[model samples]
Target: MRNVSINQLDDTPRKVVALGTDYSHGHLLPFHTHRRAQLLYGATGVMQVRTSDGNWVVPPQRAVWIPPGVAHEVLMLGVSTRSLYIEPGAVDLGQRCQVISVSPLMRHLLMEAVAAPLMYDRVGRDGALFDLLLHELTRSEVLPLHIPMPAEGKLLSLCQTFLNKPNAHQSPQYWAEQIHISLRTFNRLFRQQTGLSFRQWRQQACVVLALARLAEGEAVTRIALDFGYESPAAFSTMFRRVLGQAPSVWLEAAK
Candidate 1:
């Protein structure tokens, strides 16, 4: 198996490895792609991957499927992550990348795959293992954590800046002016490109930040205040609206 630098990874066949490890680095890898599909899951820690498609956060309950040869990067707490890589042609797994929730059966299968003996020479076992992994993957749920990318170029840049900061709420008109476009044009273009209004986009970003904070076990009051809510109650209301549950409930489920 050839281990190339992350920059050298592309959508081509080389050495495909089912690599597993726990890492807590904030940004796991730079924007990159490889010829093999990657199944990134962390059963014990917080993990999130950002691709051009959107953000895929791997909670203990889920796994992220990265299609073969797609240029994507990951970011999260670098602690313990169980990442697996499979070649499109090598394994009977799909080339389409996505995020899937982890079932107890799937988690147990993953553990077995990683624990296989290095000298295990049973092709039957290997094939069975890969097939089981693929089966588990087929049952994965595409999480909403993957917010689609905005196509309005200038507006997209503006949105990205806000997303990166994630601490301040930018008005749509302000973003429009910053992008040298009128407020009306900005709204029109955003809806045309992303199927979401400016407000929806911002809310998604805010929710992503909130999820990160929640994963860290941050206090609800402080997290809400940091995100510019006047009070925790308001923030909780908004959270329930977007997430279909209160922050505490969601966190409890995650825990």
Candidate 2:
């Protein structure tokens, strides 16, 4: 659908509108906002979503909740998506965007919702399906797949660079000096802007990026060495520390 048509549907009285779309690897949607909140589910591949507030990664069978009017952009990594444009006030999702798990039932509901009439009978099967969809959304589990970016331009740039070549071994002093700030001030500002300490942020970034590489069939040992870990065991330990599961188990769940 065209951007203008999408904007027109923002406040429909129907309460919910489901749209299905697909993109090839590396497709990018530039920064944009919608009048309605969105649940963007990736049925086949991963998505990297970025807003000024932070960055989030959504892998296959996962989704992201974007509150109404929040400007964001999405990059598709071989994705097929089912997106729900929910009228404002239809659900009670908080303001920030978050990555959420998609249950098997939720997956089927989304496929059904998109195939039904756009203005299905209020008391009919389509309406019932959407009601169930909303209920399931309320109970969906939030995933630790977000990497919050700092607001400051220089620091945010530094963080972005680190994401391209994430190294968990990088010291606080190294990062602080790269940004030309004292270690104490850097630590304070980093937490102030991103709500995470430097070390915590780095680990989260690595984990999210690691998910993409793992999906692409990269060996765990290569990923470990590329990301500066001493060994695959070390990488597994760090991944478990942040995600509560070993890499293999986590990838299986994501698959």
Best-matching candidate per lDDT: 2
Per-residue lDDT of candidate 1, residues 1-255 (tens digit): 122343333332333334456565574677887656677777666776776655655655567778777888777674455556665655544544556667788777777766654333446685577567776676676655655567547766766777677653568878788878889998998888767787887777677677777877788899888888889898888878777888888777655
**Whole-structure CA lDDT of model 1:** 0.67
Q: CA shift at 223, candidate 1, in angstroms?
A: 1.4
Sequence-dependent TM-score of model 1: 0.79
Every candidate's lDDT: 0.67, 0.88
Collision pairs in model 2 = none
Expressed as tens digits, the lDDT of each residue in 1-255 for candidate 2 is 212256555555799888888788999999999888999998888899999988888878899999999999999999888889988898977999999989999999998887877667879888999999999999999989899987878898899899888987998899899978899999999999889899999899999999888877789999999999999999999999998999899879877
> Stretches of candidate 1 above 4 Å error?
1-17, 24-27, 89-97, 118-126, 167-169
